[model samples]
Target: MSSELPAFSWPTDPSLQPAIAPVPTERITPEWAWGGSTGLGMKVCIVDSGVDGDHRAIGGMLRGGAVVEETDDGVEVTEGTHSDLFGHGTACAGIIHSIAPDAEIYSARVLGKNLKGYGSTFVAGLQWALDNGMNVINVSMSTSKQDFAGILREVADQAYFSNRIIVAAANNTAVYSYPWLFSSVISVACHAEPDPFTFYYNPDPPVEFTAPGVDVDMAWAGGKRATGTGNSFAAPHIAGIIALILAKHPTLTPFQIKSVMYYTAKNVRTELAAAEEEKRDE
Candidate 1:
């Protein structure tokens, strides 16, 4: 049996900027709602520059994965000795391991030594994750090109309906990006704060959660480490937590996962505080 693709938004009308918000209806939360779980056995795929499976920080944790190598024929995905070309993938994997130590980490290497890749490679990596049965995918990279937007959106929606979660990072700049902006995925950007466990759900659209991605220390290539900042780093933190959520619940749909994230965010109490103040006045 095959699954049907979810809805798509081409947005060629040019009537609005960044597309006029997704109307899923607004539902607010009063407090944190996630529980404790070790994230054991959850299949978490880091779809980035690939994971340095040999990195000490990841030590004996990788379940399995593949690397998208370029060939004259086109793109070839090879499954062996894949290590982080740059420090990005390892850093993301380290963050996830720190948060969810027991979650089985996998790598779908798409980026290269330059830490950048074309849209086709990005899409290919994601499709590999979906096909390989990854429960949660961490995509710290996105293609800003308008050409690949529709296809990426379709894939993201497919992941959503298929019970797979794709946590994506918004672009570092204000430029437009796909997969992250698509409503099907959990789009994230960096906030000024430093708490890895702290996340804020935007009551607005395009971007959803805001987590730690500033001046953060993380694992790097060649068993080294570094401190950096970007929405890219923030994404893994969410993915790690999602692994924990799945560990305990094990059957949460994408919609339900979003609800858990929104309510569990640190700033979730603002509206509740307002509601309480209203009651106090009466």
Candidate 2:
């Protein structure tokens, strides 16, 4: 004599597809932007694979900073090229520069040559970025689990204390990812033409905002042009947007700026999702 129990399944309706909002045209729409342009002399730090400081798209954007980390000998790991050997970081930096042409980008090499590294390195990079007075920090990488939330809160707290903002790439999977999942941080989702030929896709929820990710044309290492995927490519878009927001609303707190983005985002997904739902119901 067992009791019946109900089962649960994730939303399957096509209408539930993550909708993507179109990139903003105003260069600044979040009321925060009333303060100024994205770059406007603000400094942003990108903690990921190193960036190629010589890339054309990054001409004036690269900050040309050095990485300082503790080594086996207790000395700082400071020797290495600033070049983004894997091309991932350089691409992220390019997107940031495009939106905030005046913002300077500083890269902290944490992922190493393979574009992979330890959580310790990521933390170390954050410390470096903060110590360097970065106005915004873009973290494009994540760990295997959603455990980085606390660390993100701590970092965001420190940045907040210093009047800086920390933006991160939302995980690519359907599940949650760290730093991005941390409510204290601004989590940016990837958005672009699903098919290279298509214009764009509907926006996704739980995602605070969207940026160019799919088929996104950008700069690469060795002065090359390339296209690729990943939330890594999307984080910088928010970073740049935040910079512009700060430039305009110099008095707005990082938290307040984030709020403005949510309310001001051009929600192209809402209607798209409704139409898809009607079709499904029919």
Candidate 3:
């Protein structure tokens, strides 16, 4: 005679049901995620050198911006319009504009002409973005200094909790960096793939996604266009996608938006295809 086993109650049981229903995989397709979305009514901040609002590639999407400069007292964040000190910020803004043309772009100029700035200025720029109601902040720069890591992590966590999406670039070289290394922000790196829309999700930690960044042709300062390659460019591609996603679904939090990205990622698509094939065979 066999002994009767106790029933195992699943979480799906009515008495133990979760407050929120799980999203169906089929509903997380690209068409459902960002189709027909032009990023209208979304505010995206580019925290970099600066943004040239006059750039042809930007198409007058630049709304307003701020400049963060280190001073004797402390970091001074000046609010208003600013110009791109280097072409880097324009390149990032162009990538995002190309993908999400209608999204309002704001520049938080932290770096000067040398493409370098004090980590304090960088933190100030990011803080300004969060305090000013930016929906998505594209941070193509990171500080390798451990001195700023603690403060940077705090800002990153604040963004995560506030439903703000921060898309940060992984360091181009094998070096330690803050913000990007933090789990709170969406970290991106370059994939050799040239298609701007084609991105892959990595199961690995730290770097969660890869986008087209190799030899990417983007807008430059002085109203010119140029080709550049770096993880910096990759961050904007993901930021652009986030803008589009938010435009379509404005209420999605940072966590839910990341889930949407994971579900729509190329690797996930491959898995979906294999599952469909297996089902057909069965």
Number of the top-ranking candidate, with TM-score as the measure: 3
TM-score of 1: 0.85
Q: Candidate 3: misplaced stretches above 4 Å?
A: 1-22
Question: What value of lDDT does candidate 2 attain over all alpha carbons?
Answer: 0.71
Best by lDDT: 3
State residue 230's C-alpha deviation in candidate 2, in Å: 2.0
Write down the worst ten-residue block by lDDT for model 1. Answer: 25-34
Clash number by candidate, in order: 0, 13, 0
The clash number for model 3 is 0
Clash count for candidate 2 is: 13
In what order do the candidates fall by lDDT, top score first?
Answer: 3, 1, 2
After superposing candidate 1, which stretches have Cα over 4 Å from the reference? Answer: 1-33, 277-282
Candidate 3 vs. true structure, TM-score: 0.92
**What tens-digit string does per-residue lDDT give for candidate 1 at 1-282?**
635445674445577435433324234332223355768879899999878878878866987888886678887888765778898999999999998888999999999999978788788888989999999999999887888998899899999999999999999998778889888899999887877788898878779999999999899988999999999999999999888888877767899889878766777756656777999999
The models' CA-based lDDT, in order, is 0.85, 0.71, 0.94
Instruction: List TM-scores for all candidates, in order.
Output: 0.85, 0.75, 0.92
lDDT tens per residue, model 2, 172-258: 887666667665667777776442111122245556666667777888878899978777787787788778777766666776666
Candidate 3 Cα RMSD after full superposition onto the native fold (Å): 5.8
